[model samples]
Target: METREKILKAAAEMIADDVTATISVRAVAARAGVSTGSLRFHFPTQRALQDEVLRRIYQHFMPNDPLRDRSLPARDRLVNCLRQMLAPAGVGEDARRAFKAAFAAFIAPDPSEQVHTAYLSYERASAGRITHWLNALDDEGAVPQRDRAKDVRFLLTVLNGLAMERALPYGDSVLQSETDTLYTAVDAILGTAAS
Candidate 1:
């Protein structure tokens, strides 16, 4: 592979192995079998490197995004995209394990700077992705324009709640409830009646 691709692959591997998703220049360089100067040439600052890594991670998670499909109703498309965020958490034991790992890494005790930075990076990337979807809908006149930041925050909050719900004990109606909640949130943000 080329030098830059090698560095990115090494960094991505480190992030995948790390609970906190933190990467240091020296560590990444060592993993890539490159010098610190070479890594820095590709990504001058740590923030720049982290941002690019997170962007790639987000793209990997959201390949073939539903937001690009205009054939579906706007509300359904938005809710479907939001549902994708919760899909990884699974249900029952899988969801519990995911939450447990997250707590151990980020919440059991006070998080260190590395953990905090990693969490914020993920959060920002998620919000940015949602905002991009909302923007696209707005551009197509499928959704009304409003306070986009507020709308994004609201949608994310709903998503987070729904993700947590997956870890909780619930009956067969749980899936229906989740779908209803997502539809309600999207309709509210779009200033339309719930479908």
Candidate 2:
């Protein structure tokens, strides 16, 4: 890989650490086995580097649109689409780590422009996923003729609630129960036509 790519990879790996403590350029340089000056040469500003790292993390959490099989059942497809929002990183461990890390940055006392941008990007991506799934379901005649915008917001709210439940100090069974409940709610919300 090129030097820039190597630097990005190293930075992304650092962000993936369980702690997700502030990732400094010096630390990233050491991790990449590159000089601090070299890392700076590639990313002149600390915010620039942080933005890149967050971008990479968000990318890791994004799902592949082309890979989704639209031919699947509506409920199955809805589940698949909803899961994609969190599945790219992973379902459990990775999800926990990524969420803790990103949410920490987002809720920073005074978020920098870069951090704010990353947070907004995450929100948009999440909303887009839900909108995509709703459209797909609507296309299959599984959705009612209600206000789509409202439905999207509602689904997002439900998903966020479920994510919070997952983040709580609960057992795996609790998480599974919440997930199952989410799907049932999603099915009902979509007015699923599949029997």
Best by lDDT: 1
Please report the TM-score between candidate 2 and the true structure: 0.55
What local lDDT does model 2 show for residue 57? 56
| Candidate 1 structure quality by residue, lDDT tens digits, 56-132 | 76578767888767788888899888988888999889999988887788788677887888788778667867876
Highest TM-score, which number? Answer: 1
The true-versus-predicted C-alpha distance at residue 71 of model 2, in Å, is 5.7
lDDT of candidate 1? Answer: 0.83
Q: After superposition, how far is residue 187 of candidate 2 from its true place, in Å?
A: 2.3
Q: TM-score per candidate, in order? A: 0.68, 0.55
Count of residue pairs whose backbone atoms collide, per candidate: 0, 0
- In model 1, state the lDDT of residue 86: 88
